[model samples]
Target: MTPLHQQICQACMPDSSPVMDDQRASLMSQLPGWQCLLQDNIWQLKKSYRFSNYSQAMAFANQVAELAEQMRHHPALLIEWGRVDVYWWTHCIANLHYNDFIMAAKTDQLNVNSG
Candidate 1:
């Protein structure tokens, strides 16, 4: 199977079902440091990355934005002085999907390559 980071996100429909239970667990294993959480009654994949300073954090956020545009799957990003918090979910589905996992893995890849 292809690594999650290497997989491209497919277009999701509003009626699509969120990845659940065993599938969610399996995918989550491929991404370390990411937490599965319920926010606003919806499941999301979240992680926080630390940087040396605000500039570094903003750079990382920009990288993430580029990745999101390429994959056509965006995340919620909270950029601060030295950290960035990312939350990935399919808003159309109003929950977590495989695309979220893919984006999370790609986000990790960006951090690895940048550091």
Candidate 2:
């Protein structure tokens, strides 16, 4: 994975706390690759994208890494045989920050073209 500092887009942090409904809508619209899974206090975005082979999976991983680096946001990426799983969270807030989900959404957007 690329470095966190390089992946973050520090300038675009939304100014308001998106209402719950808005948050969900944003997630739905922007992050198609990620499935919303609510944990204790965090919103996790996960998905498994198929690949033709190991190299394709590795390419996707590299793509995600680049995006993460550019956004200065990082997701835990688990690379299995032919798929990758990503876990996203914001530790600073102790719960899911709106930005975390936003980044998740954007990352999904990035993956759309990669596939």
Candidate 3:
């Protein structure tokens, strides 16, 4: 299978189903330091990225924002002094979708390229 980061996100329909458990597990394995959790009854993929200082964190957040804009898929980003928490989910589907995995992988790639 192609790496999630290499995959492009497609528009998700409101009636589309969430990714299956086995598929979720397989995709999750490709993203290190990422955690899957149920928040407010919704499953989201989350990760905390550490940086040296606020400026660095902000820079990372900007990069993520640019990527999100490019893909037209956004994440919940919590920027802090030295860390940024990112959460990925498909709002239209009210659940996790393949796009979440792809974005998560792209986020990881951004982190790698930034540093």
Candidate 4:
């Protein structure tokens, strides 16, 4: 990431409690792979990829887990067959946060690169 963009991201905070409608829209656009759930203000993503059968899916899940751990953030993970769903929100912020969306996008990038 560029230094300027990194600076901006570092300065960001989670969306304020009771997420505003417009902010939600803006954040959703910032996230390409994730879909914004209006009512909950959470980002949700589901993707299916070829994974050398079930073992590959498991490996990918582990990778995601490691990423989340290192980020000190977590996303709800649902693994089924060859699909994975990631749901991200900030509990402390009580809504979706900038970091959450950023990390979600990073996750997508990781998946694409791995593929």
Quote the positional error of residue 40 for candidate 4 in Å.
Answer: 6.7
lDDT of 1 by residue, 12-96 (tens): 9998888988999999889999999989999999999999999999999999999999989999999999999999999998999
lDDT of 1: 0.94
Q: Write the residue-wise lDDT of candidate 3 on 1-115 in tens digits.
A: 7888999999989998899999999888899999999999999999999999999999999999999999999999999999999999999987999999999999999999999
Stretches > 4 Å off in candidate 2: 1-8, 11-22
For every model shown, what is its TM-score relative to the native structure? 0.98, 0.67, 0.98, 0.70
- The best candidate in terms of lDDT: 3
lDDT of each: 0.94, 0.65, 0.96, 0.62
Alpha carbon lDDT of residue 80, candidate 2?
78
| Collision pairs in model 1 | none
* Cα-lDDT of candidate 2: 0.65
User: RMSD to native for every prediction?
Assistant: 0.6, 6.3, 0.6, 4.1
Between candidates 2 and 4, the one scoring higher on lDDT is 2
Could you tell me the TM-score of candidate 1? 0.98
Error of 3 at 8 (Å): 0.5
